[model samples]
Target: MLQIGLDAGGTSTRATVVTTDGECVGYARSSGGNPISSGKIGASSAILDAIESALTRANATLSDVSVIVAAMAGGSADDSRDWLIEPLADRDFTGTVAWESDLLATYFSGTFSSFGYAIVSGTGAAVIRVEDGQIARTSDGLGWLLGDAGSGFWIGHNVALAVMSDIDGRGPSTALTPRLLEALGISTEGARVQGRSPALPRLITALYDMRPVQLAQFAPLAFSEPEDAVSRGILESAGSLLAHSVEAVHTENGPLVIGGSVLAQTGRLAETFAARLAAQGIEPAIVRVADGAVGSAVLALREAGVDITASVFRRVTDSVARMR
Candidate 1:
């Protein structure tokens, strides 16, 4: 028998088809599947499209699958399942279906352990404690406005604020100013030609016109010039906040899976987070994951009563990697 694993995230939806023995047979990706962002109808359509494409690649149908495990961004909400139920029913799916937060899928992607902690720092940030493949507790997944302290949005917002302050003669100058201006398609020379006085106002207008999360576009500027004191300070502060979030949910030593762009990438933020954890004597086996679809597949295998030995985990990872 075969199983399907689905990771329905804010940016994309991915589906993986795997045999009972953990070999990945097919995979496919589709557009964003977050109901909160894309609306239920759009998210469901994207998810179904990804699954159908993956099944087609595997030369199989839902009837050949024993189970499907979907790890979604807003999977815990009361109406979240509504995004999938009708679509799956229409496809004539008869197998068992399971739902979980994407956090769990990310964690299992890195390790087979049922107990561990997960830290995600992409456009938003969150930390969770996993017990028996479920979230036992969580911290700081409040989106770009209220929280997400160490996220890309947090870093980018700080970058924009720093640039504004610098332009207004209230903050120190840094390399990020020019870089951010270029990234925004704002000609610095034109701003200067139009008179430095109007530059700040123009920037304010541009910033206000964008969706708040679009601020995350400037996050990479922090790493562009690693020696800039202002950028360094921002990253350090972000790392501290992430460490604190991890501390809030972490209780014992188990694999600590860190994913998402900010924390998974090897750079200042990841280094600072590791240093802070070390300072607190909270070292655990650290696993980094770039995608959660494989983990979702592993969860589907587990639901089908397959034991996830180290060799089995390696088989799944190797097969998925080859497919990619």
Candidate 2:
């Protein structure tokens, strides 16, 4: 029997199928699958389609799968599980089913066991404290309006605000002004805000209108030039904010696993994060979760009765090394 895992996020849904011996058999991808935001039908359809496609690629069927792990976002489990399972069951999936937050994918990607804390810095950010395979506590993640201070959204929103302030002569100019305007496809010189700027484009309006996830795209500006005061300030502030969140739920034991696009990269953010962790005196092992598929596969394989030895994880990691 095969093991299958699905890591569904707001941006995309990924499914992978592997054999009992940690051999990659199939993989599939699809668009955003956030059940909470996209509705149950949309989420389930995306997830099931990916799984079905993976099965087809592997020349296998639902019945061949011994376990199915689904890591997703949005809504109540009670609200979405039936919608998620009925279709799979209709296709004859009689395997053990597991449901979890997409964040768990980051955790599993970082560590084989369910121990350790995970700090997410992707579109939206959150710090999760995991104990014995279960989440113990969560810090921040209040979305863009309320919290998520150190997340991509936070950084991006700040960048946008800075740009607009500079345009209106309310804030000092930063290198991000031109780059941000260019990113938004805005041809108007951002400095025209003090003059006769007629009907500002939607790109300018996006500073107030774009969704939190969309705004998060600007986070890269803060990391572009680490030596710049604006960039350095944002990066260091992000590190400090994330460090505070880590302090809230950090445990004495277990490795500290840093996940998400922001912390995963080797830039100012990564360097400052390391410095902040050192300042906190957290000398535990630090791990990076480069791929969510690896973690999701590890979780499902274990449910399928595969031993989670280090060598096993290494094999699984190697199998999906080409994933991108």
Q: lDDT of each model, Cα atoms only?
A: 0.87, 0.78
Tens digits of lDDT, candidate 2, 1-324: 999888888778889888888777888988767777667789888888888888888999988888998876544555647877798888887888887766667787767766788778887778888887777898888887889878998888887777777666687767887788778776764455447343245456756676656888888988886776777778888877888888888877677777778887677776777787778886558888754777788778877888878887777777766544
Estimated TM-score for each candidate: 0.94, 0.88
What lDDT is reached at residue 9 by model 1? 90
Top lDDT model: 1
> Among these predicted structures, which one has the highest TM-score?
1
Model 1 residue 283 CA deviation (Å) reads: 1.5
RMSD of every prediction:
2.2, 2.8
Off by over 4 Å in 2: 187-204, 322-324
In candidate 1, what are the lDDT values of residues 123-239, reduced to their tens digit? 999999998878899999998989999999999999999999888778999888888877777754443544465567668889999999999988889967678989988888888
